[model samples]
Target: MIEIAVSALLGAVLGTWPMYQHDPARTGRTSPSLVYTNQPNVVWKTYIPGSPSVPIAGADSSVYVVTQGGYLHKIHAQTGTLIWSFPIGGACWGIPALNPQEDTVYCTWAYDKKRWWQGHVYSVRSSSGSQNWEIILPGGGSWTGNHLAVDQTGVLYVVDCSNPDGMVNAINPDGTFKWSVPVPDVGGEEDLFALSVDEARAHLITGGWNSERRVICLSTSDGSHLWSVWTGSATGISACVDPSSGTVYHPGSDGILRAISSDGNPIWSANLSVVSTPALSRDGSMIYCPGSNAFYAVNSTDGSVAWSKPIGSSSSPAVDGNGNVIVPSSDGHLYLLSGSSGNTLWDVLVTANPLSHIACAGWEDRIWIFVTANDTVYGLSALPVEAKENLPEGFGVEFKSAGKSIYLFMPNDAQVSLAIYDAPGRLVQRLYDGVLSSGGHTFNPTLEAKGVYMAVLRYQGGMKSLKVIR
Candidate 1:
């Protein structure tokens, strides 16, 4: 009877041990598949009227979008549902900027009143869609159709085209005027068009409107003049700041993208035809931008093209947390490219003109893409794949032999195992039996006879077999 009880206890322990060996909660997180170039799985698409500008200000799993028909919309980044919309009595040609901490959105609009284009700015609560404040520009002029930029401290900056000499204004969050600075008067023939802001250094950068195109940086704190540089003649310039390094990246009408230091010194620049504003990688090691007819990745430190692909004219590229780039193109398709190589990994076709700038947020272990067109928005889901061949997910691996030991290097973490089989098809040894992290792992093969061996790696819902000659 004592022996029977001991055997029963041993069986119970074995049954429960398997349960605890690989708890689904610990190792069964739904990781991305490892299939090469998996196609984009569109979650949902909602149609809207009129072409839409880029969606912006993603926070708490939602994206705020604006349309050309004076409509402001809040979309669920994961589900593509329209949570709310507010009409501002004009065309919203630019994207909305959100102050997530303050739960407020700042946007600009233009309406034709009495044959004149009237421009106005409005601040609305992000949660309730209530108008917090409104500021109308003085003496409505022809709207140049530019975007409003917000600084770190919640100040809004915009260009006032109504003045013969374009003016830049800084307003407090509550709609009170802080300061305004007049742009140097260009000949009446010149027109100013786009604006960007650097909040850390309190500088405002504006581009477009002259035979000699330029980017002027102005102080946001007091509207003081900082620095300005001429970027040969061009139009449709866009600029953005690297959130990690505070470096300013601006694409010029001249088809050149430049990186400027915080103090306004040129770090590096690249020539491209109609490039979009640079989208920074999460690690800040690379910048993704749209070329004239392709997407390109450039090294952030020196502005060198690391990779380029023919993906057609694109909206501003969005970099996901896993270092994948989601690019929307005029061809009516969203392409996912490998961030390191600009290789086409996947593509999903949508309605025509789905080229609005893409915005991404991490939700429920998936990266969500918000695409806008004709007043509609679509959400796309992307999950990371598993590591391949001992390499980390989304990376490569290599093996080298040194004397009696083998050194293996993987770019990412992976499940790996090794076994030795004799000519009689009998298992001789078991080398390893668990998952390995990214980087190098070393093992001694000296104990095995000088014969053929096998290494097996199971990952990404697949398996790979490698033959080793000992």
Candidate 2:
């Protein structure tokens, strides 16, 4: 039996990243079997004026993004060409959350420069950028780093701020209100964290950054109050939730990182401040934080700084499957740092303005990490490391992750069985069980669960598997 893995890291489904930072957990992790520490190759780029939010992928790795100019643009991630644009009705600074079922993407925006104070969240077709529906937010607005998020259940979580009080609203797939929980004791002005969930426990989390510095948790099932904690006196951006343990790693307003237990008690606090949010490694043992002039890797358990490398940016860090950190910096450079030693692998200037938004997509062997800076979107790809084994001769899987699709092929038309299984080895779906043709064949299997999975292909001779993280 031969073992196989794609891009090493897994998370974010087959490819269309519907969530803000790679899914409901907001883990900021990517599966790229190989990414160079040295400057990566810029596969493609396009100019999208008016400060585009980080791009989300649609079918076939096509890109969907909302611009501050009040337009939703769909561009091909591979060629960087414009597909279509839909009027969003206002300026947008928040990332768009995708509801793949309805072919819709959700975004919050204000008609003018007043920010989200006069905000509304609308759904647009990921295919044509056509408006599906709009919902006027109860409160004024929510800001950049901590925006709306969607869980695997297809429920959208958004923070509506009327500050010093705010409401966390959960919306159904049809855009109907499910439940809204209020975050009280918000003294005054507030910048809340992005909505994230510990899906296993049905917990939804958000927090305030300003005068109302608190991390609030609510039940996803009924909007019941779970727990709320004082985040800090300082301002912060986002929180990383570990669903398995129900732990939350919050970088509060003051920039210090704190670990809170599932029961709402603080476990440990670390001296880490991030410009945007923290990126947890796949194993949950380390957190990658991007600070104003450097990046830090902290031990998740004891709050110890494992390593720090210089990089100026106020954006979230992304960890590839290989455990390499990709940092898009305001210093006008995209840096690659070793997640372990914090050694500089490579850096390249992409924009003169702040590179604050980053996203990832894939097409076969090329996995592109994208970032927006100076009204431009840059797509980067790394070279394959020497250690990875090539696919079995005449048999392979072409992963079009951005589309949640896979292409499998064999040298000869042979009896092959391909199925999708969760990490626990339970069958999710039986994609095919017959003689497969030699040419690459496409299979579209909808993933319902949010966790690590494997798309295993077997024949009478042997078995091969590829990791599929949604």
RMSD of each: 16.6, 6.9
Q: How many residue pairs clash (N, CA or C atoms closer than 3 angstroms) in each of the candidate models, in the order given?
A: 14, 14
**Window of ten residues with lowest summed lDDT in model 1:** 13-22
| lDDT for each residue of candidate 2 in 1-470, tens digit (9 for 90 to 100) | 11223544332233335566776767777543324443567778898888888877743567777888988888887788989988877677778877644577888875445343555778777766777788876655433233677765668887665555666778887879888666665522355445667664333334444444567778888888877786544543557786556788877656678888888999998766666668877677888887776788989888888888767678887776567787888776888788888887877777677886677655543456677776777777653332134543223434333356776656667798777764322357889998877767878877865655567656544444566657
Instruction: Write one digit per residue (lDDT tens) for candidate 1, span 1-470.
Output: 00101122111100000000001011101111112234547788876665666665333556776777778877666666778988977887666776522568878887777767667888988878889998876534745435566553567766666545666778888899898666665312236455555433443344445433666677667888878766665555456666446677777766788888767788887886645666666567787777768777888899888888887764676554246776778788888788887777777887776466665433323445556766667776655334233443323554445455556676677776654432112245666667878888876654334433334334433333333444
Error of 2 at 128 (Å): 1.3
- TM-score against truth, every candidate: 0.68, 0.78
Scored by TM-score, the top model is 2
Model 1 TM-score, 2 decimals: 0.68
Error of 1 at 470 (Å): 59
Model 2 Cα RMSD, Å?
6.9
